[model samples]
Target: MASALSEATSFVPDEATVDRFYEISGGNPLLLRALLEDCAAAQDRETDVLDPCVGGLPGSALTHAVTTCLNRSGQLAVTVAEGLAVLGEAPDSALLARLCGLARFSAMQGLRVLRAAGVVTDLGFRHPVVRTVVLENMVPERRRELHRVAARLCYLEGAESSQIAPHLAAAARVDDPWGVGVLRDAAEEALVEDRDLLAIDYLELAHAFCVDPRQRADIRIRSAVVRQRNDPFAAQRAADELLGMLRAGQLTPAQSLATADVFSGCRRIDGVNEALAALRGPGDGAPDGPAGRAAAVIEYCPPWPGFAPGTRNPALEWEGRSAQRGEEGGTAAEELLRRTVLTDSTLATVGNAVRCLVYTGRPAAARHWVDVFVREAERRGADGWYAMFAGIRAELALMTGDLPAAERYAREGLERLPKQKLGTLAGGLVATQVLALTRMGEYEAGARLFEQPVPEDLFTSEHGLTYLCARGCYNLVTNRLSSALNDFLAIGRRVRDWGIDQPQWIPWRGEAAEALLRLGETTEAEQLLSEQLSLLPAGHERVRGVTLRLFSQTVEVRRRPALLVRAVALLQSAGDRLQLAQALGELAESYCWLGEDGRAWAALSRARGLAEECGAEHLREALLLHQGPIRSEGARADGSYEDQLARAVAQEVVSNQWDGGWRATLSNSEKRVAALAAGGHTNRDISSQLHITVSTVEQHLTRIYRKLRIRGRDQLPVDLQFCDGPTTSTPCRTLP
Candidate 1:
């Protein structure tokens, strides 16, 4: 059939080709192709049409070429053109129609022709740039003229916003009041449809045409949020702009509160502090109806209505009280910080503030606020707000070490959010699940959550931060030091970008810094930590604790006891038992070196107890693996890896000299197996210990043979090398 079509067309080349197709049949593919088929028949050759500009018709012969050779050739020429047109140009149906017209063809017919030519596809306008152009191309007058018609058609056809944006925007541009109103309504419907990158697109468009300042602020805030996940720098820039608006008093107190939300997403401490400054700025001092009420929801009304926390800043508390009563506090403190909390806008800032506080480690305060906000949201039957607050509650639970509760709340939040509207919230919900699973020792499941394609416009300093945490944790547990360092560096970049000054991230920063220290980048690590400590207040316990740990480790390795003592003191005050244990173990080792057995035993005992209490198996294992500090009942001994090797040579034991055998005695694996043997680690633990198959461990032991070795893992001594020790070159046997 294709050959018959090919035999009915003619070829044309050069300058006349561009004009030929159009001149033949008004550039109509069906009509021009008909003419070309006639031309091909006259030449008595298979219809073969060649025209540089196909317009509506390339020719009957070319059709056969496409249908037979070109289509099967895997050539990208036609596919590329279609991608450029459909993905590159047509965002909306109206724009599609206009593009068809510009190409001098009917919209439907043009699509059919492209489809026949295998040049265009129907991706349904998920591509943003395509949609942008399509909507923008419809002249304002025409768009307004057609918006209502297009909307009705779309509604009847069950079409989506992706199918309706260009029409609505066109209607909005044409000043068709009904079209504009319907477009606004459609925008809201579209916005609520998903929690994805696409959701941002629709919301942003709606915000652009929205005259309602409050709604626009809401959309802008959402846009900032989506942007923060994809490009933190851009997110910061947008957040700063919103802060600027708030600071300039251009936005209402309510708007300022919403704008502050955009800043909350800012990972940088600088951005957070900047937003905090704006949120607490001078304009916040005065009363302004519902807006004032909204502002007070976050600031003044501590945990509940008309009640404030005792820990609240006295001046701020006093100001909050005065504002709630509609009476000025009559002081500069009051004037600098004041806003009322009323029923109208109570849900917006109140819940978000609680979330922020929890994340920053003000758990007690966050709990105080969350209790009030959750109750209020439920009482009002605001399901959306309920879901939002519920999610925040779940996050707060995670922060407080209530893993089960966090999982339950996260599940409940996911279920509550409308199924159809799961876009970015879905991503957020999934991320939460990853955190839970990772903490529960399910690394693979957790890694799956990060598999989503990162959109170009989606900004996330937080995602990067969280990713660094997860990746680093995995590497740390698995002993993949190099991979762990990469994750740490990634986290450092995010931290540097986010400018997070709070102590919440200090532990991760410390871990990364420690990893750098291990990688022999001590100078760089010290400088980094020094810079970190400079920003933190001395009163901050976590920062001080981490600083001390790093200090103790770095200095003590150089045998500096004074620095170690200072580090131990700092860690002790922070209740960091695990770190304290490790630090004390190091001190005990030093004591052994100095032949102070009694002091070493006391420190070692204290370290063991602390490690057990903190569930620090790794640290405990470290202490037990080194024989030097062992003060068993009345026995005290000091030995090093070097001393062990020396003893092995003296014994002439064949098992002693093998590198693997040496490792079996003092290696971390052997230490683990020993600890687990004392605790009854099955064959599984033994396998886990050597990071090898249980069969392999058994084989090594069997090779020791009956006369030379002990039986079973239980009979293995702490210092027994499985293979033979090294033999020296003897002077007595040195005859020529």
Candidate 2:
């Protein structure tokens, strides 16, 4: 896997460029090679690869191969292959039969023929490149028809509705009642899978088909909830439309309350307040029901700003000194949970209940609720809900520093994810895996995850915070300080810009402060830590401990050794051994600076033990450095302790400089072009391979020559290997 990735990315110079390649190729090795070959062809001066032949064009060689293969296989095979391409790289034989409107035996025969022709792999197409070529060659109308057939087949096979959703979306128009019902089901399934964008798309499709006013209003409300993270304005528009329906008497009191529930889940605080006011109006026909009371509780005592309204704490306004207020709020929230469990244990209600408990700092209660929800979902055979609940469990485990548990839960959740190209649940599970591995100090394992193509939506507001945090930590551990700082700073900016200033939810400020401190900007680090400390609610002992440890690192070691000790105590209380080990190492250094040899040795010993136990290589190395003769009296006689520390810092800076310089020498794209050129691919061939203009390929070659300090292609070394094969490295053989 590493060799394949390195060959594909050899021309790419940086992490960002590698990420781009992954995004383009979707981590398929064959597709990556095809792109590289096209790039090589484009860069060749002698080859005249036409612009129209690039990418998945109709007359491209790859496309021609696919066309020839299908032509030889007969019409039934051609139809089956086209359906599979539209559905994606792979489709089950049964599902393909349904989509192709063929008998099961005939469909299997067609598949066998395609496989024998080397056009199909067991999983799907022989390569995604072939799939793309086939799909792009089809007429738009034909493609839409295939999608429609695929959607109906998936629905009939009892596949998860999310699997059917994109097909429906691609079909463009669904005016029939059965189509509308399918869309509605797909929307609900999308929501459970956390594919909010897909949910919104399905709901809109359903709305276009529906004639009933109340049903349309319901779809509009649901759309608002799904759109909140990516399109707040759209959510607000949906809210407005629902309000219009309410005033026009198109919705019943119960329906209005349900709409309010949706509004609350979407975090539209103003919408929730308005809905509650309508319910309280004289002769408004608002039923005094559980939904209405829930809305009233949310209106009266809103959650902390940026807290999703779906997870509104019934006890938030009552948790202070007023016992009576606490009881009323707590009772209301608990009653809602009870009713939801007994009467309507819908996925949405169970999810909201779990979030409420978690945000309220009640993990034990939250865990219990989650267990029940998972069991209920299983009983109902709701795989989507089961995956979502399991993901939440993984997140909770991560928060509590249970690395093994988090990994287990995340893996289990991922198993239930639908085989869709873009799924929010899959993104969350991948993020969870990244977080668990990185936090556990497994940097190499975490780095390998970048080999997989990250879904574009993973970078959107819905999952951005988690993605940034994990990436930042990975960068930090890998000694990419500047990159790490950028990621952390982005998190800070995102929170402020979004008006979601709930630090306790993500605690990005603390991570940023750590980065700032490492960069030697102590004043900025101090300010960030101060703000973070202030924002931390009382009783958040674990986060407070983590924040204080970072804070101590920003100040003079001699002046606040006590702060490190206090942080150690707090971390111990929080049961975060990994962090506690880091804190001990910092405390040991502080003690060493203060001329306390005995305390320093004791601290180092404990830290080393914990680091070894947790397999924290970075922390263990630091501990080893401190435990060396540098801490002895003999070292003091040889040189001042300050001088030794300065030398170590200088060494780190010099190492970083060398690494950064090499990384900046050539962009990843230049490297790819250079490898292809050196491997004897013509400029035109490189362009065709990479799907870029020939001029672009030439420009990349020029940049590569300048960066590598080479005068011309002949100057390239004999051993300058391209990833295609080891034997291809002799540039002399490719030269005229």
Candidate 3:
């Protein structure tokens, strides 16, 4: 590398710079030599050194190098290289000879010459970019002809259709029965491997060349189904293109039914409804065969649920309707649902089923179906399906009060689906994560949720009700009372306007009542709590316990103990350790208000135990705040500020034995902490590594900062050294 750099540039590079060039240039000799040549020709070379950052090189440099090398290999080798680039498969000499119209021995000779030129190997091009460069340098007409010939050669060689597909797809919509078959098989292979774009491209290519109307419609339907598993925005574009074809009478009756199912899968309610209606025609509301089964599928998928006046939690309402429809949805819809479940369930079909099980008060059944769905999704390796269903699993965990598990699953789902591709699934999954964090008293982590950017349409979706409610709870706990109240109030407005009032989605009234009560709006608090109680269905002791706990606060003091007693019984039975801990704390507060000292301590003690078990530091902290205002360490009527400062200084001066100024003044623990902070360990990392709480780490840092005269961790002296510390059990001497 150094020799190459010395030969190409006026300046010579050192050993370290040569090693860096080799490493970043990615082990490709052609690419590396090209980089050195490009760096030599750069206009900035007057000021720059011989060492080149590969990213700074001209992209055309590699292409030009490969082109010059091919020319030096002579005409036969150049033709062989072009054919190989067009094929992009294994370097089969026979196939190369056939595609390039050369004799087999001549092709072998050319390949040998090319390999010796370092443009290729006995296997293929040294790098994928080299292959791409060969194609890039070729004219469009020549490239197209090579693709056509390559497709024919591969087919005649008895290759699999999938192996022959790229050439046909690249041949610019050639009309061949065999090529269409190859593209179709290629599309299926791509879909299996989750190469959605390639699959869609292959299907579209086949569709363009297909002459039969039925086959063309079949391709369009397949494209729509695959699109449902992709970006919702891209799916919209595909749907729009299909809609034009539908209106043009390009689709048969059965084709329309299939298209309607695809639309339903996309959560496109209006599009599904319209397409099915067109299939039914004027008086055929209940047509048999394809049309009836299609309409039944639509009916089975709960559309935007309509709420009767005074209906508060319509998701439960829809859940009941969903059950009734499954039983009486006639033979067609029942067969589709059963068929989908038993054989091959699509996301839309299984998602609706899981939705029913999750929100309809069946935790065990919900867990079972979620596990089954997740296993199926994983087995198929469909990231989008796994993400969506895994999010549902997280929601189920949240509902069951498994706070840690809920956050874990939600995080996994988010990791699988990038935020840009999340679509409507974002709100519910994000809401689940925030709510679990809030419930576990992870307020700082919960607060970080709001800092992330979301889709502009996120707040307008149906799941926005749940997302806003989760944010409102975080706001409520963090003392943003007015913002919390506004969040809940907006949910209420959405309930009336959009008619989606699912308590499982968001108990907005209950959340608003807490915010209002905190803000001292008593009347509205009482009314909202009352409405929340009425809205909840029977048998959800968990949701009921939550509402009753809040309601206990709204009543008179004498009546409070009785309401709280009922809440404790209900929450204890419900087995939500987090909520039960919170209820116990609230009951303890009520006891204190009533001057029942013995009972107050008992309840507070139990609450604290539960809070610690659940890792709910905020709840434990709340107990502390209830006693009185927390004071600073030196705060008292004992002395003035200066007098206390002098006393503290005198104690520090007498305590220290070393002569290193402020460094000597630190306690052994404080010294260990300062050294770790100087080593760039974050507060959480320091706390974990040192076997201490984050709060204690913070306190140590505060005292260390005051003693060392440092403004922040970054300002600490880099020379400050300490062991991972003899007392610490951590094996590492420094933070990883």
The model with the greatest lDDT is: 3
Q: List the lowest-lDDT window of 10 residues for candidate 3.
A: 727-736
lDDT of 3: 0.66
lDDT of all predictions? 0.47, 0.62, 0.66
Question: What TM-score number comes out for model 2?
Answer: 0.48
TM-scores of the candidates in the order shown: 0.40, 0.48, 0.59
Per-residue lDDT tens digits for candidate 2, residues 1-736, read 3345456443424555455545444454444565456655665646543221344554544455556667777988887888788878445677777777889898888888877766676648755667876677688999999888777767767777667778878998774457777788887776565566677788998888788887887777767656543443355467768877877778766666666665544334444445544555454323356544653433322332222333333423333311223334334445566766422224444565566455445566667878887786567555555676887888777665567678778888777655544344466677787888876677778888656676553443335566788788888878788888889888766655444455555688788878777888777776777666545544444576688788777655654454565566656655567787888788778877788765666666777887776655666777898887335554334434334333433442343211123235666776667667755678998898878999999898788777655566653322132222122321111101
Question: What are the per-residue Cα lDDT tens digits for candidate 3 across 469-583?
Answer: 8888898888899999888888877665554454533567777888989999877786776565544444455666677788778766766655565566556655666777777
lDDT tens string, model 1, 1-736?
2232344433224455545444333343544464454455644555345532332233344344334422332323323223223324444545545423333244555455444433334523222322233334445554455554554455546666555655555444423333334444555554344333454555556666777666666666656655532233444556666766666666765565556445443322233334434434343433345434433433532212111121222223433343333223223223222242413233334443454354333556556566665675566443445555666776666554445566566666666555543333444555565555554455676566567543322234343454456567666666677787777666555444444323333345566667777778776565555444443432334345456557445543434343344445545544446566766677667666667565566667777777665544555677776545455545334334324323432342344311123444444444344434423356676677557788865554454333235445544421122112211111211111
Off by over 4 Å in 1: 1-459, 495-509, 557-629, 632-736
